[model samples]
Target: MLTLIQLILLLFWTSVGSAGAEKLYHRRDRSDVRIVHANQARVITDKHAAEVFLSRYGFIKPVNWEEAQFEGSASAFTDDFLEDFGDAVLEGSSQHPLRNPAWDGKDPDGASQSFISALEEFQRVSGLPVTGVFDGATKEAMNKPRCGVPDKEVDRNAAVDPESSSSASDTVNETDANRTATNSSVSADSFEDDAYHLNDTDGFDLKGHISNNTSVNGSHDGDMGNTSASTHQSQAGHRRKHHLATLISKNRQRRDVSERGYVAFSKRLLKWRLIGEGYSSQLTVEEQRYIFRLAFRMWSEVSPLEFVEDMRSPLEDVDIRLGFGTGRHLGCNQRFDGTGQEFAHAWFLGDIHFDDDEHFTAPNTGSGISLLKVAVHEIGHVLGLPHIYRSGSIMQPSYLPQESSFEMGWMDRKAIQHLYGGCNGRFSTVFDWIRKEKTPYGEVVVRFNTYFMRDGWYWLYENRNNRTRYGDPVTLQIGWHGLPKDGVDAYVHVWSRKRDTVYFFKGTRFWRYDSENDRVFTLDPEGRRYPRPISEGFPGVIGPIDTAFYDRRDSHIYFFKNALVYAFNVGANALARGFPKSIREVFPAVRRGDHPDGHIDAAYFSYTHGAVFLLKGSRFWRVAGSRERRRRLPLPRNGLLPHEEVGEQWFDICNVHPTALKLKR
Candidate 1:
């Protein structure tokens, strides 16, 4: 009978090496071997082999060979071994998925083309001959099942004890030896190695080595000793380690959870909850952790929820708390709050606080509200989130401010992305967003009808429209109530003393606003550059959407409704001048060859305004002023160049596509 030591050495020499062991069999290449002799190899491949194998090792469930292949020659045995083998897989073995024999080697082969490869792997992990064939040694090792050692075995004589001989003690018997080996948990190594504990760090090959701690024989002992002798010996002194690192604690409010250690734990849980629902999330693990840290800190003065991680933690004193200051919030700090739809304030990004007192409301005040919704919104604020204007956003400031947590929404996620920017993936993959301090509004504050974006849609100053000769000449106050959808009077139309026209009359009502200082009145909407490009302190300029202008003096922003509409307004100028001059910069979508000049792709517009003027099959503008309103500005150069800076009044826009920037001269 092949001794366990001999069989083990057979495996190690054939497979284990610095370059990793290779497999002997693959699921694909099995039709090759017709005969394999292993009786002397102690590998019982007969009809009774499986039962004998199970009886040896008490680990995992035993095989139900009700399906054993009792036909053919060695083929029957091989098939039986394979079937029993599938059972071992169901039971997770000591090797782990990574070290599993199935994964061994660099075979450019498949399950069919490499039974030898798989067999090699099995031998390597099982400590048998990894010769790429089901050698008698391999079959013997596979028959040796896995098992745990019992205390009784610790006191028993050695497995090879010669004095304890009995009728079952058949020295040349392969089945008996395999039985002893499987049941003995300790390979001569585990029972003998002096350094096999939790703290051992020997075989750790961060960049090298195969596996740690394997059983091998010694000089006086038999065959297993030479089996990858070096590797097993090297790993004999090492310990196993798992890869998770300690989480962090961040005081600064941010939207990641990983950095906040304990705090991150809560935030991550919250994110998971939101994700479970249909809500869109824009926070990442890192950002969520940051906010969670703050929440943990601030949780002191405000107890919204309990800080219970798992079922463990001292519950001796139901009221016991951690850290300084206490009156419930546990002395944690409660710092900021928000003002309007633009920003919602919070103390710490992670902590959840509440007031059991009177009825209150927010942006400004109030405490008692939806715990989840408030927590979500405040959690955002804690993460340095500015407010998003999307009507459906969670941070839109339209919900009750007192709630501990707010619901998540698509808009809320977008606003977060705008500030911090995102991976540019499906809106779903984005996480805690960041926002640089960039105000696109005025003294009072005014955002663009829509964002200009990384896309240079609003890069120019005055890209006036082509004048259409029509209607009479008259002048009057020009303004719009809003763009409400219902049948309302004067709300969805643009009117001037001349004849009012509804240019972008489509959907939704909105508030009207202007930047800090730039406003004036003009008889023509397109022909004149008020204060001309020369008037610095005067209302700078007004142009269609997608206009960008370079100015050391003022902020240059444009407006758009359907097709791009960029409005250049300095609130101070508007408060002074009766009306600001509005220009129409229209660029229609074009197909290849449509324009020999290769300009104009698609038109962009906002859904907020009341004036949409379609110029032609391709161009459309907000039709206002007299029918004789002339587009006096020089036409543009078609696209943005590398070293060009757009003037405050003379900007550049994509006359054709949003991606292509056009310089309006």
Candidate 2:
């Protein structure tokens, strides 16, 4: 038998070993819990990100308050109440006008403040509480419809609603009632609907007249099917008629007889090839290919049109052929002056030719013509849009070197939508795309440099080799000063030879970020235009930009809003003119033209393989050259496709952990 001291020591060592093992087991269990929590949280985070993304880019204007009543619904109140509401909130009445306003009419920020004060004064005069909030009774009073501009006469023949009623202050008047009659007999006979068409000779015109009876004044349909809030309607009483006249005048313009308006290819799917002569020296072969691809993608996004590159041979029967030619180009009767006269031209179902004699710039050199701009315009002709006289139109008769690249004017979008129908689904922002990428364990954010944006919070991913750690989550606000009341739509980190800035897009505005100091800066510091309108900062551009990224290869930053992509030159603080191109044009194989359903959630360049990766839903693609070569990613191990519903895996995993331990034992 062993001695008593030896037995005691042996028993003590055994007990100590058992206790240590238990402690280690508990620690491992806690680690697994944390991992599981992160996975579970990903979906919630992504959902918020998606919502913010959608809100920023969608056509819906940000309302001041959800509870605010608008003018259209306040017919129970007197017309005087409506007219007075407009005068008080918009132009201001004599009795209750704004006082001591700081704004000089140029600064939007100052103007907003001045407008609020005017509202307060109006409320005080109207015997309501003097709150500047744009909701409830205040919103109802402010949104009342009124007459057009005093100086300019809106053509009565083109009027949408030829109402001549004076507002009733105390009681209705018989004369006013007759003048503001709602009968269909009151019509604008001189307003020919076909006159609004691009080319009457082609027997092509918009199918139906734009609706004139909507109660909401200054409300316009966005290109992406979102409701763009009317900024100009803030002043109009007879807003509908005024707005309609403007549209009609803008649509009716001079065009060459040969270039008929609203033409479209019969086939939804078509193949295009490059001639053996290749592209102009202005842009590299790759750049030209991308630009052309971009042009086609934009049209496809809004219509049932798809373009595929004919990689086989130029001799093959292709729907469209592209090449460079001078003077008497392509053996066709059409000729080019080669300098500034005519940059490029394309006939329906015919080849698109670029002027070889003129100097060209791929993006912009400020020394030569822009190839991308000319390509978009020529492609419009190929797709069946005649030259329009709209100031910002892509199909304008002459090439505008100063216009933003891929600038699809409102009229252009409406015209194309009229021809091919509209986009299959509502436009999705870049964030919406990322959220759709359902990872097996949920989407884990990747951090590069000092930024760590995820959903509504930001954190630092700390690691010393394999031991990974995360800092406390900080709520991301508009200016990065404190806790954010709401989530952001999209975030981008730009690092290139031109700029070192991060951008955060939210609502109708975006903020420039200073990563080094963890602060946000406005576009104009003196003006305090931190949350400026997208149009103000970027001419011919609207927001919210769904997602944005810096392309190291091209040294350009791209902003994706809805179905279009805008290229921004950070160094120049200028949007690369002739931009806001369609994604389908750049990447053709992703979807058919008849069904442009999906959107790119995230995009990144793979320097390792010299290709670009675009993620859509659960699948990701690797695209190279002008053509899109697609390879699908493997499905989840649990056999769940991204769109398919499946049972929860975390719960199943948790239940199995204990059993797994017992099995190991």
Backbone clash numbers for all candidates listed = 144, 21
What is candidate 2's CA lDDT for residue 350? Answer: 52
Task: Tell me each candidate's TM-score.
Answer: 0.19, 0.29
RMSD of each: 28.5, 37.1
RMSD of 2: 37.1
lDDT of 2 at 337: 45
* Regions more than 4 Å wrong, model 2: 1-196, 199-263, 313-316, 404-406, 426-665
lDDT of each residue in 185-230, candidate 1, tens digit only: 2211111233221111111111111111112121122244344544
Q: Write the per-residue lDDT of candidate 2 for residues 136-177, one digit (tens) a residue.
A: 675443322110011011112221221211121111111221
The candidate that wins on TM-score is 2
The global C-alpha lDDT for each of the candidates, from Candidate 1 onward, is 0.26, 0.43
